[model samples]
Target: MSDSPDDSGALHLKHVLAAAGVTDLTDVFAIRHTAKNDGLPDLWTASPEAVLAYTREQDSRFRVFPENPPRSWLVFMDDGSHEGAHRSRFYGAYENDGEALSERTELNRSFHIKASPLLAAMKNRLVVEWTAPRRWHRRGTLAGDFRVLEIADPQVIPFVGYDKVRLTYQRLKAIVDDPHYSRWHSALSAVKGIYLISDTSNGKQYVGKADGGGGILGRWSAYAHNGHGWNKELAALPKGQCEHFIFSILRVFGPEAIQRQVDEAEGHFKEALLTRGKFGYNAN
Candidate 1:
């Protein structure tokens, strides 16, 4: 089946299949995989290997068609958006029955599948709107049920530009640790800037500046590694309180900008925002 176009003329999964030269779908099954369990890492930011391992585990959990399992499978990971409208990212295509079927257990009944080169280049980059949340798996003959979201850049996200930056502590830590967010690293590392660390849990804020040691990225990296980033006030916070901090840029300066300029900017923000008072987190 083909994806029908809407009035917006947005592309759909059928268009992607057509582009991939996958016209026939009789033996193809499409599946959406999510952590489903709490405390698991979000699939959107998880490492590729982790995503694959999770996918394999979910794929083997049950057999919808034990006697006539599909020969090929289309895999996706939940994008962690709105309940009904989030796009699911394509993980990979696979061939079922890659090995002899394992003995069936109450939960392990599906055939083992091996990754195929089909749409290999599109992994992480291709996202489709999976409308069938209740039915995570469906035969590929029903391709029209899913719509194309977009073919996004493979990075966790590109540099959102300095003024537009806003990151929670966990996301900031992920960007610092994950190589996939190299774009953010490269962009942030090139600029010296004034930043705000707001304790979202209590609404208190700290004004800080990045003038050296690898620029904004380096300064933020310190905060990501230790919630306090050596700041006396933040260090005094009870354990894990820093996890509520949200980082954002207040002003960006080039590498050529002098330390004095950055310091002055930081002072201005601290004074203007009353970030050094009892209501704020800044100690200085």
Candidate 2:
């Protein structure tokens, strides 16, 4: 093992990999996977199997590399710790077979990757600031200059609390569907709440209620499945438009809370946010 952190207390990515016996930096590449509205689950909260599946199925359509694709891959999960500077947690390393596939192919190119143990111990423990914030993927030779933000303890992003709840549509779906997010499911299912959905594309807001027996989880599950939970205005959105919607809670009620009180809370938010106005998405 080598000293991962340097004199300036900054650990360079190249130095870390070099310490891990990755002698051939030219054959390697790095990818920073971020949460998106794209039907894919958030890798940060996804199961280990799901993570591996995503890493192996490097779809050729997105055009990550036009030529000179590397054989070894360094996967990282986009840690949304900052807005401008791109910080990512090292996921793992994988070495693929030496089969070159055409980048123009639209089909999914499944790489036969044998999990590399080179950086196994450092997974999730290593944080690096990606130099190219705009580019999701880059050649390893070019990415070696990334500054290691930390090599601290493994990060555990918990389902902190209901008051702090905020999620994109993609993350909402993951919490509902993925078994890995059962803690989130338990918390959300225990409360009835007035939720807000904001369409980031047009800056429109929708205040909705989740007073069902299944609580907020049940209400949002519908939106997770269909992008719109049968709401008149939400259903009218153009295809894929609802992906821009973000979900958050405004108020919560216990299971025994009166139905009328929940209704009043929902009405209160609608009036305050002016969701029924032209700038909003609420139809009523």
Per-model TM-score, in order, reads 0.54, 0.54
CA lDDT scores, all candidates in order = 0.76, 0.78
Model 2 worst lDDT run, 10 consecutive residues: 152-161
The stretch of ten residues in a row with the least summed lDDT in candidate 1 is 57-66
| Global local distance difference test of model 2 | 0.78
Q: Can you write out model 1's per-residue Cα lDDT over 1-284, one digit (the tens) per residue?
A: 44456667888777677677777777778888776454233444455566555544443333543355577788887775655677787888887764345645555443566788888878878888887566777787775457777787765564546765778789899899999888889999999999999897888999998887799999999999998888888899999997888888999999998878888999999999999888798878
Off by over 4 Å in 2: 1-9, 59-63, 66-68, 81-84, 100-108, 155-284
**So what's the TM-score on candidate 1?**
0.54
